[model samples]
Target: MNKNVAIIWGGYSSEIVVSEKSMNGIYSFLDKNRYNVYKVKIDKKGWTAEIEGKEYIVDKNDFSIFFGSAKIEIDFAYITIHGTPGEDGRLQGYFDMLNIPYSSCDWMASALTFNKFVCNNFLKNFGLNVAKSVYLSKDSKYDINAIAEALKFPIFIKPNTGGSSFATTKVKGIDKMQEAIDFAFSEASDVIIESFISGREVTCGCYKTSDHEVVFPITEVITKNEFFDYNAKYMGEVEEITPADLSEEKTLEIQQLTSKIYDLVGAKGIIRADFIISDNTPYLLEVNTTPGMTTTSFIPQQVKAAGLSMTDVLTEIIECEYQKIQKSL
Candidate 1:
């Protein structure tokens, strides 16, 4: 019997476009021979399943779709939603209550990694190198000059709970601190300010299969823009080199740290970590529990560089969850 899979995408966030794009690529690569897949879209309007040019409202009660009198039961949920309920543990919690397996970290891991400040601090306490930063909420007031003085110039102000650099700003002086904070707060109530680190920006990805727990090749991100912002990441404004030009020793070190962070965070399906290598030390930026699955995204490119196919990557993710479901029964 073919397992019914719901490739969940679309969310109420600035990254909705990213989610849609990545999900389209994922839908194409999912093994159609062994599984029946449905495109599940969720946004401010409602949850829907668009199949065969006809749209059917999804039954949130069971997360299933109905075609006239027939109901499509989802055996596994491949969550590709990038923000909010998708990345912040809300969707994972819902699936847990329904006893439906998913292809991402558990609720706790999702929640922890979704908040950048908390995740960075947690990893720092674990002896991982992290940049110095300050946390703020919309309800709290901080002296602008004090924040500037603490972090120094050329600081990064970003929403503490969002992704795809929706409201991230770089401030080179005290005059820009408030503007940056407001920009970040517009996206989320909480924001973070971090001292700038001048170094090579890179990222690494990892996933757990039925047998292999692997880390893909590291990629160096060099951007024409100020930093690796939304444009650099999605609009092809940056150059990404796989198998980053580093010594064999440097590559092994980052790879080891990547796998260490993955296991420490209790990530299940696929996780990618961004970092700034300062003088050969990898400082953690953020860990993505729901890394983008689009064909052009970093994970896919890294997979290819590591001599792995997208088919193998996606199958391992889906089948890994399927096996866990079997074990639970």
Candidate 2:
């Protein structure tokens, strides 16, 4: 019997487009012979499941869809929502209450990694290299001069809890700091500002199960813009090099670091960690628990470079989580 699986997407954030792309990619990769897959779109409008061009509302009480006289329940959820309820742990909490198996970190881990400044600082205590940064909340009073002196110029201002580089800015001087900060705050209630680290930008993906651990190859990112912003990420304004041009030792170092971070954060399936290699040290940029899965996204790129099938990787995630749930019961 095939279990019903839901590929959830369409978040309440600017990253909704990215989420939709990921959902499509997963739908193509999942083994139809093994599981009955459905596309579940969760947006501000409502929760809906699209089946054969028809939309059915999902029952919040049980997370199910009624088709005619049949009620289909979701056995597993492959969440691709990039922000808000999905990536920040709100959805995870809801699923947890229903004993639902999901393909991502738990609520605690998701919440921790979603907050850029706090997650980096938390890992810094374990001797990880991260750029110097300042954090601000909606109610906090910030002195522009004090911030400029503390972090210097050529800094990055971005929403502390959002992704897809929406409302992120690279402020080259103090003249643009306030404006950049305001732009970032428009996207999130909190903001994070960090001193710029100039070097090669690379990202590595990793996932672990009770049986084995897999770390995909690194990808070197090149962009003409000031940083890898929204345009470079989705508008095709950048070049990506798989199996990044690095020596064996450096490659091993990054892969090992990625795996270590996975354990440190108690991460679950399919997380990607980005870094900036400066002065021969990899500085932690940010950890993405729910990484993009579009055909051209970094995770899919890395997976292909490793000569592995996305189908098999996703199967491992589903089976592993399912087994864990069964054992707990």
Candidate 3:
């Protein structure tokens, strides 16, 4: 019997477009002969599963969709939603309650990684290199120049729990710090402030199969549009060099660090680690639980470079999570 799969996309954030693209890439490679795949779009409007150009209501109780005359059950979810209720752990918790398997980290891991400040600091606690940062909430008091004096000039201000570099600003001077912080706050209630790490920007993708972990080749990101901001990541404003132009030593070091962090965070499925190599040390920026599966995304590029099959990768993720649920039962 073919298991029913739901590819969840269209989050309630600016990254909705990216998530939708991710679904498009992942949907085609899900091995249609092995499973019945349904596309689910979740936005501020509602959650609707599209079947044969028809919209159906998805039952929140059991994560099932009403297709025409019958109720369709979802055995697994391939979550690609990039922000808020999706990547921030709300959807994972819902799936956990329903005992439905999903391809990604658990609710706790998802929540922790989504918050950039907390995740970076947590990784730093394990002796990993991470940039110095200041965390702020909606009600917290802060001094603009004081922050500049502490972290020095040229800092990154971004939403604490956001992705795709949405509403992220590279404040090059102390004078623009307040404006950047306010802009980030517009997208999220909390914000993460970090001192700029002047070094090469690189990222690597990794995922666990049934028996062992697989880490893809690293990619170096060089952007002309300030930092690797929204335009640089998505709109072709940057150059991403695969194999990272690094020696074997640095590459292995980074890959090992990424795998180590995955275990420490109890991460599952596919995760990508972004880094800044300063003085030959890889400083962890943040871990992406629901990494973009789009063609232009880093993971897909890395996978292709490694000559790995996307179908196999997605299948392993689906099967591995399913087996975990089975083991628990």
Q: Specify the poorest-scoring 10-residue window by lDDT in model 2.
A: 320-329
10 residues in a row with least lDDT, candidate 1? 311-320
| Model 2, position 5: C-alpha lDDT score | 95
- For residues 1-329, write the lDDT of model 1, one tens digit per residue: 99998999999888899999989989888889988889999999999998888889999998989878999989999999999889999999999888899999999999999999999899998889998899999788689888777878899999999999889998898887888899999988899999999999989999877688888899999998998999999999999999899889888888888888988888888899999999878899999999988889999899899898888778878878878877887
- The candidate that wins on TM-score is 2
TM-score of each: 0.98, 0.99, 0.98
Q: Write the per-residue lDDT of candidate 3 for residues 1-329, one digit (tens) a residue.
A: 99999999998888898998899989977999999999999899988999998899988778899887899999999999999788989999988988999998889999999988888888888999888899999998998878888998788999998988988998888778888889999999999999899899999999987798899999999998888988888889999999799999999999999999999888989999999999878889999999988877898889889999888888888998898898997
Global local distance difference test of model 2: 0.94
Candidate 3 RMSD to the real structure: 1.0
Sort by lDDT, best first. Answer: 2, 3, 1
Q: How close is candidate 1 to the true structure, as a TM-score?
A: 0.98
Query: How many residue pairs clash in each candidate at the backbone level?
Result: 0, 0, 0
Candidate 1 lDDT at 293 equals 84
Clashing pairs in 3: none
Each model's C-alpha lDDT? 0.90, 0.94, 0.91
